[model samples]
Target: MTFREGCWRRRLRGEWFPGTRLTLRALASELGTSVQPVRDAIGKLTVERVLVLRPNYSVQIPNIDRELMDEIFAIRNLLEAEAARRCVSVMTDADIDDLEEAILATRRVYWVESEIPSRVTTIQGVSRILAERCGSEALCEQLINLRARTAPYYAAALARSDDGEDAEFVTFTIRIQDEFVTALRRRDEVAAAEIRKVDLYTFQHYIYRLLDVE
Candidate 1:
């Protein structure tokens, strides 16, 4: 990656706070490059929605808003569950195997002895893979957008100390995955939808509690 691209990536990873200003001159100074590269980087990130252009004619990091978070999760629940249900009827043996392997791998990557690791882009990656194979492109696209927006929260939750919540959190994930895979294998659309609803609600509750305590 170019220096400016690397910087923008780091900023997306929350190395820089939301609403951080990024002017061409300032970024050029930090990147030790000319303004052209900075402009290129800014343009790329703008397309990705990783950076937002402010009304005052400067670039700023995307800011977190509670309402937006809710809407994202709500749409995520609807589209993902529906798509997963649809996918089961058309799933090949290889698809089931891949889904199971991806979930198991994500379980290991996300939780280390019931403790969250410092960086967790892998879990998101795997989730995207699972969501991608769904029957509907529109559903997958919506899920991708929702997951991208909510990723930082998941990372934040992982970075939190396990404290006494380790067992509960791990168990929750295991239960959700079990229900999901079971419903898929059986082609039980109703069960799959219910499981997803429960999973999403439980997840929101956990995040709220964790963030509140922190």
Candidate 2:
């Protein structure tokens, strides 16, 4: 991708910042490129469900219903905790090391004043690897789709905090993920399952607050 194209995609993914409604021209100007690349990138992201195109051709970062958002995360918890638990017997030393590395990387970025999308991407990247290593292809795909369904959930949470994601939320998430890793290291299936559920519900809680359901 052109630097301009890459930057535009990054913004759409909320890598640099949370985005609202943005016109193609405005995005093009910021990227310092012509409108063509912006248009192409926008089209691509829309297909990825990363951007929603309005009737007037303006693009928006997705905003989803809070109830549905929470439900997706719950599904993710159910699918992925089982996957991780199952994968334990099959996990090699290298796989364990990689998981440890991902955990550390997540901790490093947890409190950084970076954009939420980038942070979300980092979390998901490691998770995808962990999920895929599980013996079940079907479970892996389900977890991936579940994660993707949370795109709007992440967007809404980032926006709701207004000043950006609070240190408390970040720290809580890092701690939860670490507990999950600990469970994995110990081959404690029940503990792993519980920690994963906490991560899922805590994420749901953010949306619940937004919907005033909590």
**Which candidate leads in lDDT?**
2
lDDT of 1 by residue, 1-214 (tens): 7865575446424355444576778778887888887777777668866667765446876555666667667877777667667767777768878877877876665455433322445455434665777766777766765665566566566566364675677678788978888987888878876776776667766765665632
TM-score of each model, paired residue for residue: 0.72, 0.65
Best by TM-score: 1
RMSD of each: 4.2, 5.0
Which stretches of candidate 2 lie above 4 Å from their native place? 1-62, 159-165, 207-214
Q: Name the 10 consecutive residues with the lowest summed lDDT in model 2.
A: 10-19
In angstroms, the error of model 1 at 21 is 6.0
lDDT of each residue in 1-214, candidate 2, tens digit only: 7743564445434453224687888878877888888888778768755567877668876665555555666677778778777767777768877877877776665456676777667656656776878788888767765665565455555555533545666678788888887887887878877887787677667556654556
The Cα local distance difference test for each model comes to: 0.65, 0.67
